[model samples]
Target: MVNVFITGASGFVGSHLTPILLAAGHKITAIARSESAAQKLEDQGITTIRATLEDIDVLAKAAGEADAVIHLGFIHDSRSYAESVEADLAVITAFGTALKGSNKTLITTSAIPVAGVPTPTELSPGKIPPRAASEQLTLSFSSPEHSIRSHVVRLPPTVHGDTDRGFLAHYIGQSRKAGFAGYIGEGENHWPATHVKDAVQVYKLVLENASGSLKGGEVLHASQEAGITLKTIASAVAKRLGIPTKSITKEEAGQTYTFLALFLGIDCVASSELTRRWLGWESVEKGVIEDLEGSGWYFEETSVTKF
Candidate 1:
């Protein structure tokens, strides 16, 4: 069994990923920020490191001893951009310093929206360069820089599934709260997606492939369905909540969802052909629009309480 180290193991993705690796006979060394969270990790037979991802010295020491490192911690607050940058940079530097000369595996999550051209063509590959520049910065250290094995897995906008706490959940919560479901403009903008379990399996595959080497600084997209449009999601949300559905102006969307407004507007159809072809990653995720329309979680949360 390989010994793997993971950052942010108490989060949505990290929580789901833990059992998968453990069941596969891999031992996990996970980071937990709280005492209760650390106890939970221990209960599950995981080695717990009680430190945030930004604690470079602690993280580096932990990472230096592991066979692979999965970076899943991120600060979603855009208001603290500089602080977030500082933290993320520190973690990256720690990883480099800890595994500087080693060819160990390191995987970090990224996204597809902010990487490349607004409308990417078939000719324009989606290796990287989307919403987050962190991919380039992280993978830049591969071989040439620090000789550490590293890669970025760019996730689709909607990581739809039962346990998701991200975009889809927010959409459902707000739609029910507002007594309507809708989108901006023509609602032609696409939201890429993959199931949580499917994405986790992809990470496991990357971990096992020691011979493949992920080519220092590699960026792979975890897109399962590339073109689930926003309008479709709105209609689904409306049906589940028994609410009216329609389109709105961009100004309206901006007002309703201040932080997510810009994100909901980006349309990019990402392809994971490279991951499938190279790493043999196969997606078993149910289609995003189809599943969201049917999930009980949407209707379960009352409009009175915010998500």
Candidate 2:
């Protein structure tokens, strides 16, 4: 059994991932910032470590003891993007220091938006959007000399699924508030997407085959749908909410959207062909619009929490 250390173990992706890993006979050491969260993990037969991303020593110690580490925790404050990236960089540095020259595996999170090139590829080289330093730090420790098998999973901007209170949820909530579902400028900009289940499986495959299946410093896109038009996403939400979909100016969008405005304006089409070829991974699930409209249970539940 692989002794895996995972940050963000109680969050959306991690919550789904832990059970799968356990079913496969992997032992999990998960980090939780609250007692309630820690208790939840412990209840599920996981070893809980009480700490936040700020606890570098705790992270380092946990990572040092594990056979592998998956870094998924990040500060979600969009207003403080710089601080969040800095924390990620520091946390990565700690993991690298602890696992240096051990050839142990480390998998961290990046976003498809960071693939600055128009057509995103696994080999596309660029600083991650908003925070370039963090990705650079992650890729730098992935050499044979460092002896750390490192990789970055570039997640699509929207990973939709059950209990998901992400960007799509925010759109639904805003649609309820504004009396209409809105898209920015013609809404032609495209955003890649994947179901949470599919995305988590990609992570599992990468972790299971880290030492052999993937090259160090490789960037894998977790996108199942290469790109779905913003207009399509808006139409889906509008249809669900029984509201008209309208195009809003960027200035109007700034006032309308909370933290998702900047992202709504971006067109990121990421390709996972290389990741699929290398890891034998494929996303066999409903696409974003289908999930958002037909199967997604989030809309049936409470709209009180706006995330």
Best by lDDT: 2
Q: Per-residue lDDT of 1-307 in model 1, one digit per residue for the tens?
A: 8899998787777888899989999999988889999999999999998888657799999999998899888765544555775677678778878887788878877776646656443224335433255665567668665877787777777876766777777777777767877698889888877888787777787788745745666677777887678888888888888899878887877666555676777787777777777688788767876687667754676422212
Superposition TM-score, candidate 2 onto the true structure: 0.95
lDDT of 2 by residue, 1-307 (tens): 8999999998878988999999999999989989999999999999998899999999999999999999888877544778788788889999999999988889999888886766788888756555556677778888777888888898888898887777877777877788888889899989999999999988899888743767688888898999999999999888887889999988877788877787888887888999898888989988998887785465664654434
For each candidate, what is the lDDT? 0.75, 0.85
Query: In candidate 2, which residue pairs clash?
Result: none
lDDT of 2 at 42: 98
List clashing residue pairs in candidate 1.
114-130, 114-131, 115-129, 115-130, 115-131, 116-129, 116-130, 139-217
